[model samples]
Target: MRKALTLIGTGLAAALALTACGGSDSTPSADATLDPANPTTITVGATPVPQGRILEFVDENLAKDAGIDLDIKEFTDYQTPNIALSDGSLDANYFQHLAFFDQQVADKGYDFEHGEGIHIEPYAGFSSKHQSVDDIPEGATVAVTNDPGNQPRALKMLEAEGLLAGIEDDSAALTLTDEQNPKGLKFEENQPEILVQLIDDPKVDLAIINGNFILDAGLNTDDAVIVESAENNPYANFLAWKAGDDNPAIAKLEELLHSPDVKKFIEETWPNGDVFPAF
Candidate 1:
């Protein structure tokens, strides 16, 4: 389970950073620090869907109570947040998982640390034509995320569903055949973001999707044919900041993110289980 989650984290990280490779080729940022007591505004970077909404909720409803003035910087993709966080443009970021965090920090030589996990965006499989997993026919073309972090989750889910066998390797080298895939399922691989758009494609039988993308697309989890199990899930996203920089404002924001207000908000807002709280 640990190995699979780690692979999924790295997979999503790569997919998120697809347009541009991480570690360099981006502008450098100055170190971002926050004042604990007089946090007029602490800037944070996050992807637009649930992360932005969750942060907005805290900024609007909770930040003021702890004397925190919240400033949210919406990042469309995964590359910019780490770039911004590293150079100090962002006080923190909350769109990535620990596996992605670990891979990026090590590869990019970034000094970063994450707070307790805030939520788990379960990777799931959705089909517009098929009603259920058992209903999937032979020679069906399945689409999976092409990244390392997310691919394992999809593969593991398929494994759990008795579609494929165990995967020893954790790269994009996976292929579907009758030996491991008795159903004769055909597999197509694409970037995590692109898979969402391919959902309605006539050629695609199943689109393995990220939970955030599902929510962002305004689709509910209840519509999915299969969702990766949440028990011991390793893809939980979290708030991350520079290592050794214990900015009080960042700390306060972290605390508020896991507070009852955020929990209640998530519980009520994502009743379909798209964004499961990991706190």
Candidate 2:
């Protein structure tokens, strides 16, 4: 279930090619021309952990000098930020990966443009009942994300661990194949936020969680039995806004996100390899 959201630091508040052309009243309008002398405030929505923290860093260190003021709204659930962005509650958002973003675009017809990749959160599977992947027994219950964009990733990770097989990593509609259940593992799906709690569930033997949720849950990456490799990973999260938005401040913020200082911050903050700079 998507949690009720509140905006941090401020009050809370499209899809498909032809859908882009068919504009909705909820769609954010293109940023109007700004006066060169005044600072512009660009409201962006993001998740609480790294996305919000990274934006806080930019708001403190770089935004002022760049003639921008960032009003960041932190979201706990994945669906709300994009909804906020679509409904003009936020000027932009930075919570979703490319696959998730594409899924949103295709499903909802959001006409949004995104910046280059900023950071990668390596997905991992954690088990409190077992010491290692090999320790997981047959018919063990595993918890994975219910979101279409991320479920396949969890399936792929399980496949890599030899728990399951016959998975198409790129398929959004992917699901467990009973015949391919080499270990006879039972799978359960939950919201990404709920997966962390499932990690502690006595009935759940393994919980595959998104990195940001792991961080938010105060879980350590080193404890994960299996982690996704960051090499050439396409799930890096980036800045996104309504399409045709030519806000100069948005461009500036995107530039700062990929800057050396931001890179250093990400490396030092998450030195444990949970988060990697995707530049």
CA-only RMSD, every prediction: 7.8, 5.5
Highest lDDT model number: 2
How would you encode candidate 2's per-residue C-alpha lDDT over 129-231 as one tens digit per residue?
9999879999999888878878887787777778777788564322445766777787888878889988879999989999899899888889898898887
Cα shift from native, residue 70, model 2 (Å): 0.4
> Which residue pairs collide, candidate 2?
14-109, 14-110, 15-109, 15-110
Off by over 4 Å in 1: 1-38, 168-184
TM-score of each predicted structure versus truth: 0.81, 0.87
- Which lDDT value does model 1 have at 184? 74
Mind giving the per-residue lDDT tens digits that candidate 1 earns over 176-249?
A: 44566777778898877778888899999899987778878887777888888989988778888776665677
Cα lDDT listed for each candidate: 0.74, 0.79
